[model samples]
Target: MTWPKKYGGQERSFLDRYVVTEEFRVANAPVRAHFTADRQSGPVLLKYAADEIKKDVLPRITRGECCFCIGMSEPNSGSDLFAASTKATKTDEGWRVNGTKLWTSNAHHADYMIGLFRTSPSTEENHRHGLTNFLVDITLPGISISPVHNMAGLHEFNEVVFDDCLVPNNHVLGEINGAWKQATSELAYERSGPERFLETFYILTEMVRTLGTEPDNRSAEGIGRLVAQAHTLRRMSVSVNGMLQAGMEPVLEGAIVKDMGTVWEQALPRKARDLTAFTDIGNRTNFDRLLRYAIHIAPKLTIQGGTTEVLRSIIARGLGLR
Candidate 1:
């Protein structure tokens, strides 16, 4: 929602976008078709892409007709993004990309991928200096996607391979081999969003439904603590959105929000299960099913956007403790 008005975005305040995002998440809306583009890719294009690229992509994104997948982690990379070895060699026509991106979400259905690839050799003095960001057309030749299902038997994740895939010079985002400068700012957008905490919100809703208005002391206390935690996280997330709107990179604040939010969300299923242990078995069958699915999906929450350990390190560095 931060794109310019000319680009078909409403140019709404970040807080307005925050409200919309929270409403969608709480309602369990099927937003996966446009979530990545709306949340991170659109802002990235606005800030870094050329006018032509923005003109071509932003409107489609705003129309919810395009899907984007991030290509940051590789087989050996994961949270250590600097360890990525996917290569993009300069060619007479444009650039030739060859590598495999592991654990890329929605790659199978993505219209585009904002890929990070190695463009030069990393020196000992600056290991992060050699990477570049390219907006790859997923339908291009030499690009292949294979499904990598999660524990829930869902096929949302994938492995994408590039073999001499051609990326035009104009498709390069920001400066060549200077993507590191653009990365942290992008992550500030990615990590501070309401999605971090709201993924498991269904479990909390189910818990409340099963408990009804009047509850025992333990159940009430558990519900109160969960609600309080959710409120605190929403406050933190909204504050970061304000910072983003003000044109400041609140990397530390974003990291803290994601770190805490993801941990809480990852544990929410178990917490809800415990809180509803004494609920009438007859009324809890649906709750039990939702809780089971949440449990299955919980492990990936902390590891997806960024791992807990990596986020803690970022927060520590921001606090001058690392």
Candidate 2:
């Protein structure tokens, strides 16, 4: 909704996008197919890509014909993107990439990847330098994807390897060695979303349905608290979106939203287990299966996008706490 009309966008407001996103998330729609493109990738290209690239790619994304994935978080680097060692050497033709990206969600299904590769060594005085963003066609030669099943036995994550993969010079997004500026601003789009807090929302709805209209004091109180927290998160997330709509980068606000939202969502299953322990909600809508799935997937929520520790460090530095 934020894109211009010529790029195939409706030019709708951010609040309009937020409402649709919230509904799809709560209804558990199969949005992963285009979620990355709709959320951050399209916006990234809109901001950093050349006019020709945007004209070619953004409309495809708007038409739901393209998918995108992030290419950060290498082995040993974890959330420390500055420490990434993935090399992208400049060649006579274009660029050759050689590295492995771990925990890449939806790489197997992606048409393109907004990958970060080190084009030069980091200087001692400025370690954030030398990293560059590239629009990688994952289906290109020398690029391969391997599935990394989660604890829930889901193939949502994959490991992507770049073995002398050639990327055109035009695919080099923004500055060659100045990706640090871009990455921080991109977080505002990545982290401030309803999905950050609503992944396991079904469990809560089932809990309420199981308890019926007249829950006991304990159950009612717990549900009330959870509802309040969810409401607060929604407000914070909406405010961040508003900031983005106004062309301001809400980096710190976005980090805080993800940190709090992920923590709350991660703990939801445990709390549901404790609160519903005495109830006989087993046969109602496969609560047992849903709970098991939530529990299994909960561990990775905080680690995705950005880890809790990394988020807190950003929050700290933003607030002058460091």
Candidate 3:
């Protein structure tokens, strides 16, 4: 809803989009299908893509007919994006990309990927150089996606291999070998959002319902604490969104939100399990099932988007603590 009217959006405020996103999370909507496009890809294009590319892709994204995935992590790169070895050599035709991207979510169903590739060698003074962002059409030849199932046995992750994949020059986003600027700025949008913390919100709601009204002291205390933490996170996230709306990048604030939010969501299942241990909610099969699923998926929360270690480093640097 934040795009211009000519781009099929209502030209609404970022706050409007924020409310809709939170409601979708609360309702457990299956928004993953087009979430990356709406949240990150569309904005990236609006800021960096050529007018022709934006005209062609933004409308499709707005129509919910396109899916986009991020291609950043590699086989051994982990959270250090500069260590990525994905090679994208300029060719007569365009650019020939060759490398593997690991832990890419929604890759199997994505129509495009905003991929990071090495276009030159990093100099002695700047290791962040040589990396560039490219808009890749997933349907291009030599692009292969292999499923990487999580502990929950869900196929939300994949390993994408680009074997001599050809991308036109027009597909480049922003300056060549200057993606570091774009990448850092992009994190504010990527890291601070409702989805970062609401992945396991269903379990919280189910726990509350299972506890029923007039729950015991222990249950009441636990519920209150969790709700209070969630409320604080929402307030922080809202403030960050306001910054984004004002064309300001809250990189430090965004990293803090993701780090704290992911940690909380990851621990939620175990806390809920502990809270419900002595309760008679064993008869609540739905709660039992959800708790089990949440536990299975909790371990990956802090690893996605960015790892806890990486986020802490960002936070420390932002605070001049490191």
For every candidate in turn, the CA RMSD to the true structure comes to 1.1, 1.3, 1.2
Off by over 4 Å in 3: none
What's the true lDDT of residue 42 in model 1? 82
Put down candidate 1 lDDT per residue, 72-189, tens digits, no spaces: 9999999889889999999899999999999999998899999999999888898888999889889999999999988899999899999999999999988888888888887888
Please list the residue runs of candidate 1 whose C-alpha ends up more than 4 Å from where it truly belongs after superposition: none
Residues 1-322 of candidate 2: C-alpha lDDT, one tens digit per residue: 7789999999998879988999998998999989999988898899999999999999999999999998988996877888888899999999999989999999989999999999999999999999999999888999989999987888988999889999999999999999998887878878988899999898899888777788899999989998999899989999999998898988999999999999999999899888888888447548878899899999989988899999999999999998
Question: Best candidate, lDDT-wise?
Answer: 3
lDDT of 3 by residue, 1-322 (tens): 9898888888999888989999998887899889999988898899999999989999999998999999989998978889889999999999999999999999999999999999999889999999999999999999999999987889998999999999999999999999998887789888999888888999899999888887999999999999999999989999999999899989999999999999999999999999888878447888999899989989989998899999999999998998
lDDT winner between candidates 1 and 3: 3
**TM-score of decoy 3:** 0.97
TM-score of each: 0.97, 0.97, 0.97
**Worst 10-residue stretch by lDDT in candidate 3?**
277-286
